[model samples]
Target chain A: MKKILSLGLLCTTILLSQAQAASTPTVSGVFEKTVHAFAENHAPLGQIPASDLLNQPVAGIDEETGFLKVQTPKGLVLVARAAVTTTMTAAAPRETSCSYIGTLAASGTGSSSGFASNCKAGAR
Target chain B: MMVMFWIVYKFFDPLSLESATKNSSAQFFSAITAPFYGLSSPRSHQRVAVVTINDPTLQQFDAALPLSYQRQVFILRQILEADPAAVFVDFRMAYEHTDESLSLFQSVLDEAKSKHIPIFFARGEEGQDQIHLLPPLRNVESYSNALETSSAYPLLFEEGNAALKEDEPSQEETRKPEANAAFDVYRSLCTSTWSGQCGSFHEDDFRRPMMIQWGLHVDPAQTQVSSLANSPRNICAVPFSGGFFCRSIVQSFTLGFRAFWGSSRDYEVGHAYYPLTIGAHQLGERGLGTPAGSPPLSHLLKGRAVFYGTDIRDQHDDTVLPFLGRVPNVVLHAMAFDNLVTYGNHYFHEPSEVEFGHGVHIGQAEICEFILWLIFTGWMAFKFYYSHPEVPRGHGAKLRHDIRRKSRDFLSLSLSVNALVPAIFCAALAAFDLSHQPTLLNGMDEALLYVCLFLVLLGTLVLLRRSAQRSQPEEAEHAHGPEESEAEKAEKFRLGFWAHLALLTSLTAIVFALNELFIQWPNADWIGFILLWLAVGESCESTGFVLTFVNFLNRRSHALTSERVPNSESSSQ
Candidate 1:
């Protein structure tokens, strides 16, 4: 039981860490540059809040994946992602269904080009 | 630094329903209006015809004699006596009577011609193919003598569409869904009768959404429903204009019922049309007749008509109307009889009905979709966080088999171009809709938002997916086990942090280009170049980030699986 619990805790820690990295607001000295970039392109209401989770906090953590949870006070239900980068796309709305996404990555870092397509938000 | 590579890989995650529905808002219109399938509009005509008085005066003891016989005779007599523009006796003569009144009804048709009344007989639509119009039993009259006998079709709904042009008299085309038609059939039926009510049916937004779909307006609020014994059980003759009423064949119902119960009969309700209660009774005890005795038949018949036919053993349409299958023909006549007294047929819809059917989509589809997306994303993150790493399940892989048995079909199943299914579908839909909308600069700029979102979601998810597919031996630099050396954990974090930075830079560049080049800002050239440089930097950094994350997850999963089977497999979800 202790082993199982620790394993669970470790996994949770890794996941939370990744989520936090993902959503961590940039602290800058480089802040002016990041804000300038955001202000230059952002459209009003044109931006859809996209996420692998409902509330993304730790974003750039490796070994982090998906989860299912419901928000209280307002019963906003989130589906359990139950997946990692490699296994996420296996679901399609069956019991463990993920969203109707095509794949886990469209243009992540593996491209042979100089820049990542879009999935490199944490690699800045 | 290792985190840099992982961040770039996270940009490739698949989308969720919450995201898809939010992004695709235009389809909601069609989905919202799909349920107006029931409101049919029978063309109302301008012809005044015969009236069959269904006064209780004719019943033997006011005890409603198996009204199967006298009803036809009474209808025939009225046709003969009214010698009006035309005569329509809505009695179903096809019915079987112990003392057959078939000849008597036929004799009355003969009398109508002999008396010089332009006469017509009606049949329910489903029965039209079979109804043979007999030359009036005594076709010895002339048109100059006011005696042209005619055949009429019984239908339902008035104020539906412009009358079918003479060239297109067939009813098939008229039977399509017409929510966009000129006069709202449901609305006209409700407001035309001088009834006290105003707005047509609408479900309450707070409580109910599915609107009650009954064609006519019967207020459960106003009328005191009689005792179940005395509940108004009557067949109704709804005002279906084109000089006839829709006749429902009860024999069809009985035949169908018997078929289900191992008893077959020849009964059919060929296209029965029901009424829209406009709150006024035109031919009732308190019907359209004025105090001075003039029949309010003009206003009543303005949008109304009449119908009559043979109620036979095996001739019913038995159509399961959209919401509910209904009264057999016999019961329908009885119901129509009851329509004469206590309550008026006014058009109204309960609040609950409309909301379920139409309002919710109009009111909440977007918000619901967005919220659903957020919840789904959060859950995914949570699941991944909680489900991995063994924490040294004290017991070892020795308790379970090391080589996890995989279905032979797994590789063949997902690899057969099926893996390309989503991308292909997405490309098709994206290209298809984009082609239709005029491409605007602003819209191009908006692509930046999508890029940013997809990058963040994809980078992390892609790493997870790849690691899940590969074995651990080749997965170096991964923090594989709960007791993984701190060196591995540090390596994982270092890899992840850099990947995130690399991705953030690339996205910021693309967005900059999008805003400048696509959105056509004055500084577009400079912004685009800056974005282009950032994109290059991020891309280079992204490769390393993705490789590291994927490698780590792959090694971890393989190590865990090799160490324990059921624990890893079952706990994966």
Candidate 2:
């Protein structure tokens, strides 16, 4: 039982790393348009004071995870691909730390299953 | 130096040097040969035609930019009615006003489906998502609208999150890489034209991008117009009177220049008669409402893959190419489609070698380049050496005395010839090589090396003969010296020849490899070529300086001899 569990964990780690590498976006040329960033929980992240990147383009859409990638002045922030109409709204100041949310997502510590459920239901 | 260059090239760029060099060389070669595209323009016209929606087209429809769905439906129906081979729309019709009914657009699509016509629409970032979202455009094939530099048609596009896309297990399995708009058109055209023959080509055939061979544009002034008034048979049906005088003068000058160069104008005449363009308003204009003198639309558009694109000013979808100046983006697709039709599987692409990893490979182009360089250099060596041959001794009696005088004369002549002749020959050959630019047969450094080698070899041979002549007063220099036997002389000759051959072989290979690598690097490669050229010039100047010094010493000796003779005569008096 222990051996089987160890094997499963190894496979899962490999798959996750591959997925991360595959989802990475390459900025080919200059981008002009911008879209707002949202957390995996569909909540808006905190905006920096007098930041130039308040308006940033949607660098890429992660097809596997269904997350919209936005390059921020701090780092990349993942937004739920759902809530297309609402997510395009201007960024508002919020209480959550985007870096903390990213760390939790990367470590798989938070309740991350079905992040799009509420987004899809409330979007329409 | 060659070894050091190789080490540096590997250290900085372990890979990509081969491909980058091949790509630039191919582009340079294409630019050199672009002037001849007009010869094939007429045949290219037979394969494709473009229907442009310009400013006049909007005015005719009485609609603003991005025409309404209903207007598009009307225009699409008109195009299908003409019975074209295929139609590719270069517009992305995004979802707008969800409440609006799409039944009219759906009917037009159904009509095209019933007629068995394949109409492809330009795909944006949404890709397959849009097809799933829009019901009316589900059957319409999607093609990525990205401008590719290296190839006329790229088989795959780097799509959004390409690697992670799930595969569908079907007979014709769609891979993650989306096909480009031009490639889709070519496949459709092939199947339509040669139904049973063009069965499922391997995608790997199109993995490497072939450079776009742009075709010549039609001159409106040279287009054949119908005698009947208001006839749309001629391409002149579209008003192109904006810069008529300037165009006429340029065309006249070009014709005169070609005539002076002894080239015929058959290509121009053939292109003038080809109908490759039709305005959107003219093509979409309906039935008996069409002007009386207008020719039938089917007659022009039939059996041709048509591209539907916009040509509105400030639209910013234009590309500039040789033979054809700045043209709408759709025109590029049309030209690529035509190139595929004309060349099929035998399209011109840069020849690449099979890579077996860890940097072990053999390139055919590089091999051919080396062989040509060797052959030219060998010929140049032979020409320079034989041009200034050693003088022979006269037969019998005073042969030893004659050889001494002739050997002195030979040394002086050889030095002077070595200095000036190589310089002149190098320049002339460099000029000839530049005329045939971007080919494997042209390496300026290789020429200079061969000249230097042959010069050294000849000088050594002359010096050896002169030494033998000084030792022996009875025999000519051609015979063996008293110290050396016949067998020893023969052994020395064999050793000398083998040594010369080995040195030449190694030097040629090293120079060839270095030259090939240098030319592949972008702007930095020109510095290598110029340095090689300057090195050759420096070698020539040094030889010339030595000859000048020798000549000055001889003149001084002659002056001293004249002074001595006059003083001796005065003492005798």
Candidate 3:
């Protein structure tokens, strides 16, 4: 009974968080996408979620070469070399998935704390 | 508890582990490339801020390098490890930064997009009449908005000038406006990706494009990478928008002094890395070891994760910085990337709140305060014991007193408990010993000592007045009061006692002040040693009344002559 109650509470919390994150943002730029570009080459594999990339920083990219690299408990590894990346637009102009959530400000993720959710609001 | 939480949240948090590890390593590379930078935060949390128009209509002005959303995911995934808070791309879809070798960017964009980034061509902005106009964006309703918010990125608008210009600023013009030089803005478009990845590539990337962290916990490497065709030159050449990444948050490295100081100017900015010269002394260099045969990938991954990035200077051509002038483009990337991480934390906050990276800077203020309080307390304790010796003290008193006497040059601990002047001088010498920036705690300690000085001075004056009153014959000749007579003698003794204390204090103040300003230590380790010395000296116990006052808390014993006084002994008064 306790487990079920907690699960219900968690679900409600997630829904509430998503509702709050769906508001329109002023001057939206690509925040989460940028984090994705950042995390694409830095963070290690297996544990992290695709949604949480913006919340984490894994490594640094060489400005000239654009190679992304990270250090694990063992040593530093170059995850990806420098590359030209992209941004997006909505063809139908409907409620965007987290991708177009930047200009198309919608709801945030309810998985983490307030700041993490708030981070999604202004994302491009 | 809050502080502990913050520490755990930033450093040891399980959620940020993989990404944090990546950022910390990137920071290390940045550190190696630019050893001169004094960052507000550590290497991992380096920041990149991008400012640009987001409307698609504005992107129609020129060609945008074709980029995709899947690629964006691949790229943003890596940069997230360095702990960057924000990766702002200034433009809607037109973007990126420099050097003659545009091939590197071409390849990076291609690989990133092919993997998973979502991208599309310039979309025409819709008017109420359903007609496409000058700006081809679908998000906002107006064209004036795009024009008002952004200027041409430096990358797209560069003047490839061959000559370097140097208009030297006069000595006093430190914050000169002309410090910024003219540069070009480049334009390119990023491909699209899924919801989690699309918003990252802003057009300011053409010049001052804000970068995001790029490590993906998922194997973005195995994912097929794509390119932005809009980027005319780099469609599929350079892999991974060149070695770029950002992390979520770089934790602060708040440094503090280990102990009270000694003297030394051992931590000068360039000098720490190179022991090039110490006064007339010169040091040699450590060279790289001989090259070895390349190891297999499996062997390389045995104990260490192999990181590959170009740290070498541009063998092809040098790049130009707006203000600093020509240098290697690779170094520029290294320096700029390093600088971004270093100075990143300095922003997103008020000036007063920004830390100036004083991690390695040691100053006189901290040492002065720590030493003075320590010495003054020790001496005061000793004097209290001296004024009333018949009061029982401890066996350690004699040993402490003897050591103090031997250490001093002129004053005898037995006759004069005023060790303030010598101790301060010694402490001042110690304060000069610090080579590392003292923490805020040290600064607070120093402030407390300042209050101590003021109180001590005021107390001295009161003692002086008491002595004068006791010396007056009228006060001494009071026949009706035995208590008053004894008080008169006590007052006189106290006056003499305070005068000695005051003199010692003044001398200490002078020594600390002088050492802080004029004398720079010639060595680093010596400074640490000196601070330790001063702290030790100050911590020593005073063998007089003050020591007894503290010891009284632990045990109680009072005897004027070898015998304890009973309650009836004081009834005569």
Candidate 4:
């Protein structure tokens, strides 16, 4: 009974860890406006939804492609280097209100979405 | 003989032979206007500025096509803000457009109109004589008051028309009806948005078609363009006046463009032009900030007459000029405009009667001067041969010797005179060309005429010498008798020939050097100057020849006398 409980506990820990890995890390800091967003072919995709981008987690940038990886409700979005206009600001954690005003395009290959914004990052 | 020669020369059109020869008379004109190497008339400097829509500027837009209407509006706004003297947009704007783009474009046009800035748009013909603005823009008449159409037509007659009788009024009348009827046919054939005439516009509900004006005028102070107004219509209209007979004349679009923008300099007595050029990329760089490394557009464009057109390599706007092979159409327009405003069209007389007369009078003066030259040269040749005939030298041996010596002198004199004629003529022509005033004849024609005269003189001299020789058998035999051997006689002839040839060559060199030096002297009579030099050269050559011959004779006599004295003294001893 002790061995079975220990095995169950191990399985539960692994599953929890997997679940944690699947859930994206919450990105803090102010959201900035976007400048331009485009697909791989450079076709302009209009404005991306503010709610979709506000609390989305950044999944690190791809070094080779220079794309910004962001986790959204839909899927993992890759913003091309050319499309990305906004830089992330690391600030003291506070209620930040941001507004974006640039282009957004779907990321083609591995990423499910892409966006380029130049939003105002400020403490509300 | 002179009359006959003149008749043959004038009527047979010997000057026209210049076309067949490799060294054509046209080459002389070509050299003067040669773009790279030829003399640049002060007028060649940029007078009008051309803004070209180049490849890089096109690339800045999406899909690298012609500028979208929005971009055009932006560009137009920037240009209008710069406040040029006039703006000529050499693009068609007669097409269906998006409502938004049309409204935007209309607003820009309105702004330009309100500014009182003369903005001219290019008018083009659609399929089967249909007149329309170039595709995608509409409601042109609502926005702009004036439209620009091309006056460019075939200036030269085709082969079929060459056989038509010049004086046949019936044929001319027939041609007139055909010509007059064609414009209506053309109007019917073509469809247009303006609902007015293809080449005309409505002025206060009265439709007036465009006229072919003789010249245009731009006020230097106000920069206002005006056509030759109130001129008699159909006065200079030939059957080939591009099918527009008795039409009220107005300045061509290019001419009007030039009057406003062309840069001019007072070169000597007349004006010379330098066409201004600007690139579209530079304009875009200044306004939109796309392409890098362009000059600030404002500095070049402000208070300038700006012309905008497409100059892409494969866009087919290239034209061939006299020496400047294929150049962009805008450049051609600039050149033509410069030619009209600065030089005025000497060939066509739309400018004024006085201006046309001035050109004709200059031509007449040149013809008169050529005739005088021919007469004087002919008289000089006649006098030269007749005035200095050898006097009879008493009897037998002495007379024969004198005749032989005179013949040798005549040969040298003839050679020098013949060579001098052409050398002087060439020098005179070069000097005339370089003068501030226009040249009457080109260098090659002058050279050809002089060379022909020299050949005639040479032939006459040869015939005269042969006849004189034929008549003097006794003198010839005595002259060739035992005093000189055949080989020695042959040697003397060879030496005389070489000496004559050397003199000719030296004279040619001297004349060339003089030509270069005297090329810039104003109002100098080159003909009289050359004649004076020729006379001086002939006198000097004759004096030098006489002195040398006398010295040679004295040496020979002294040697013979000394040898004879020694032989006698030895015999007596």
Full-model lDDT for every candidate: 0.28, 0.45, 0.27, 0.36
After superposing candidate 1, which stretches have Cα over 4 Å from the reference? A1-124, B1-63, B66-73, B76-92, B95-214, B218-290, B296-299, B308-568, B571-573
All candidates' chain B TM-scores are 0.26, 0.51, 0.20, 0.38
Candidate 3 residue lDDT tens string, B1-573: 122222343336458643344333323222221211231122221122111111221121111223333333333333222222222121123232231222333443454345432212221111212232112222111111110011111122122321112432355244211101111000111222111222444423323322211111111111111111222212111222322121111111101111111111112100110000000000001111212332211111111111111111222223322111222222222223332233231211111112348764323423443454446545644543343334455655665556544543233233223335434544553354232322322233333334444455444544544444444555447434454332232333343545545645444444433433343211121222232233222222333332233335323333431254233122112
Docking class for model 1 is incorrect
lDDT string, candidate 1, B529-552, tens digits = 222233333222224443344445
Question: In terms of lDDT, which candidate is stronger, 2 or 4?
Answer: 2
Candidate 4 error regions (>4 Å) = A1-124, B1-32, B36-43, B98-103, B114-116, B125-130, B134-276, B284-295, B320-325, B346-573
Worst 10-residue stretch by lDDT in candidate 1 chain B?
Answer: B143-152
- In order, the interface RMSDs are 34.5, 28.4, 25.0, 24.1
Expressed as tens digits, the lDDT of each residue in B1-573 for candidate 2 is 222233333335436563444334333323223323333223445667777676555544434566656556666776788787788888776455453554557787778678777787775432345432255664464564434443334555455533322532353344435566667777665556545434555556665444556433332311221111211212222222324322322333343354334342222221121226555554522222234444444345666778887766556665543222344667667766766665555454444556779997744444444454345444432322221213222342245446446755554565556446435644554455445333322133334434544454455544544544444453455455455432332223222333334434334333433433332212222222222222221211213332244334445465564453332221111
lDDT pick, better of 1 and 3: 1
Ten-residue segment with the worst summed lDDT in candidate 4 chain B?
Answer: B221-230
Superposed model 3: Cα runs more than 4 Å off: A1-124, B1-382, B385-573
Q: For candidate 2, what TM-score does chain B get against the true chain B?
A: 0.51
Which docking category, incorrect, acceptable, medium or high, applies to candidate 3?
incorrect
Please name the candidate that would achieve the greatest lDDT relative to the true structure. Answer: 2
Predicted model with the maximum DockQ:
4
Deviation of model 4 at B134, angstroms: 8.8
What does the lDDT read for residue A53 in candidate 3? 31
Looking at model 3 chain B, report the run of 10 residues with the lowest lDDT sum: B274-283
